[model samples]
Target: MQLGLSNKDQKKVLTAFYSLGEVCGTIWDNIV
Candidate 1:
């Protein structure tokens, strides 16, 4: 299934996901 996103859009999505993962990791560290 394709949503027909452009390359720029895909890059933005990836960067957002990376930032989200970093935030989650920091929170996890604080909890542990």
Candidate 2:
């Protein structure tokens, strides 16, 4: 199940994921 991403790519992916999560949370908070 490994996508074989290099360390740099993995970091970028994680950063993007966290950024997306933060954006979603902001929207949710505004809605609530």
Candidate 3:
């Protein structure tokens, strides 16, 4: 299923995903 988001919305989604990934990575580093 596709939401059919516009380019601007897609960019926002990608940015949020990357931010989440960075936060997880930081936590993992602290644990390891």
User: Cα miss at 11, model 1 (Å)?
Assistant: 0.2
Report the candidate with higher TM-score, 1 versus 3.
1
Best-fitting candidate, scored by TM-score: 2
Model 3 residue 19 distance off true place after TM-score fit, in angstroms:
0.2
Worst 10 residues of 2 by lDDT: 1-10
Winner on TM-score between 1 and 2 is: 2
Q: Where does candidate 3 clash, by residue pair? A: none
Evaluated against the true structure, the overall lDDT of model 1 is 0.93
Q: Could you give me the TM-score of model 3 versus the true structure?
A: 0.86
Alpha-carbon lDDT, every model: 0.93, 0.94, 0.94
Please write out the lDDT profile of model 3 over residues 1-32, one tens digit for every residue: 35799889988999999999999999999999
Which window of ten consecutive residues has the lowest lDDT sum in model 3? 1-10
Q: Give RMSD (Å) of candidate 1 vs. truth.
A: 1.2
What stretches of model 3 exceed 4 Å from their correct place?
none
Pairs that collide, model 1:
none
Q: Identify the runs in model 1 with alpha carbons over 4 angstroms from their true place.
A: none
**Clash total of candidate 2:** 0
Give TM-scores for every candidate, taking all chains together and pairing residue i with residue i.
0.87, 0.89, 0.86
